[model samples]
Target: MENKKAIKLIDKILENLDATGINTDALIDDIKELRTYALEQQVPLVVKVLRLTYEHIEANQSFLIPILEDENDEELAEAQEVESTPVESLKYLIALTRNLNNKMNISDLREYKELLMAY
Candidate 1:
């Protein structure tokens, strides 16, 4: 069975990201709480992803833009294709967190981490 607690936490984080105006402090707090939970669960990959995500957002708060619900179809499509961007990488991480199978691709996470480091 999947860990419902983790899924709920991830969903909360995603919802915060989707909000019109993101409160950076709250987001960071949520990420830290999730990372602690992952560590307790002994999920190293999840912990790493959360740590990297926290760092990326902390360093680039001003540059971080939440994906809007009303964005044009073309822009959303473009965002999905441009995985190198930080925002897109974050979105990808959120998607990874929501995987029903509870299997996160390490390679993809590594790639996103590298991309985040580039900025």
Candidate 2:
């Protein structure tokens, strides 16, 4: 798939992930579609990150929500926004896709992928 199409798909997936109430079923479908695009583009890092993201959400159904809810608590109000971690990671993936010519972005992508895998 073209880079433009892949970026758009990634944006859509990010939108779904960042929504108020996440729908795991729909999110999984989007991830699978994005993974197919990554595979076609022959980008192994993108493919691996997408795969790990899929498995993480699959195993932890409410992974994003708890952090979000905690962020709403008064005690955590002063804390940095940890809830956006996953969303930020996806945004990095989007950045990586958009700037494939830039070798430096690959490190960010790899780092995010490692974080996801370690989670």
Candidate 3:
């Protein structure tokens, strides 16, 4: 599949449950929170990559995002803004993912950088 790297990243995330001894549901919930925070922080590149990985997870038959009846439109719009070209977006994603890997002390997210490099 063209999304192989994305799949790999998701697998590693699932694997982290066992590795880190975190509960599965709790981890997913935490990731959802991080996703929301990343959006609010206006890190479009990281948000884009995270969304893609979430899509891969959804495709595997798991629900992630909750259906919110009232989401703040202004906040969402701010998060969607892409102030850079695709190339620049990828660069930012690479740097941010590297930062995430270092902070998490897990090399799993490195796949995201590798996948971006292929583009």
Candidate 4:
């Protein structure tokens, strides 16, 4: 049952990626670091799905070009605000993971969640 839910989550992530062209190499690196923490803390399954989703996005770099190119453009800030970025997607995943894993009392996880929220 959990595996089914994980698969559905991945599908939804991919769907959102297709609908919105937003992602970044920095976001992917951050997600990889997050996954490493998840693995060390025994939450491999959840982070693995997230890792796969980001890997898919990494493969589709063309879709991310516009967003990456405009990342520093002050004029694009307002337009970008309305669309979901990779970091925002990761935050939602982190929150969902926190809810799903009742045993998650990791202090680092809590700190990371706060940091992401702050960003």
Candidate No. with top lDDT: 2
Give the runs in model 1 whose Cα sits over 4 Å from its true position: 62-88, 100-104, 117-119
Q: What would the per-residue lDDT of candidate 3 be over residues 35-115, giving only the tens digit for each residue?
A: 565566565555655666444344533333222111358565455454333323322332344344354312333445345
- TM-score winner, 1 or 3: 1
Model 4 agreement with the true structure over 1-119: per-residue lDDT tens digits: 13444445444444544555354665465456555655655775656555664565577652221122134676666565655465454444444554444544234344334433343
- Candidate 3 residues lying further than 4 Å off, grouped into runs, are 1-16, 19-27, 61-119
Of candidate 1, the 10-residue stretch with the lowest lDDT total is 62-71
Q: Which stretches of candidate 4 lie over 4 Å from their true place?
A: 1-23, 62-91, 102-119
Which is superior by TM-score, 2 or 4? Answer: 2
lDDT of 1 by residue, 1-119 (tens): 14677778878877776673345788788889878877877767767777877887788673243322223577766666554444444655766755525433555555555655665
* Native-structure RMSD, model 3: 16.2
Query: Model 2: clashing residue pairs?
Result: none
Q: Which ten residues in a row have the lowest lDDT in candidate 4?
A: 62-71
User: Per-candidate TM vs. native?
Assistant: 0.66, 0.66, 0.35, 0.40
- List the global CA lDDT of all models: 0.63, 0.65, 0.43, 0.48
TM-score of 2: 0.66
Collision pairs in model 1: none
Cα lDDT for residue 44, candidate 4: 53
- Model 1 alpha-carbon miss at residue 116, Å: 3.1
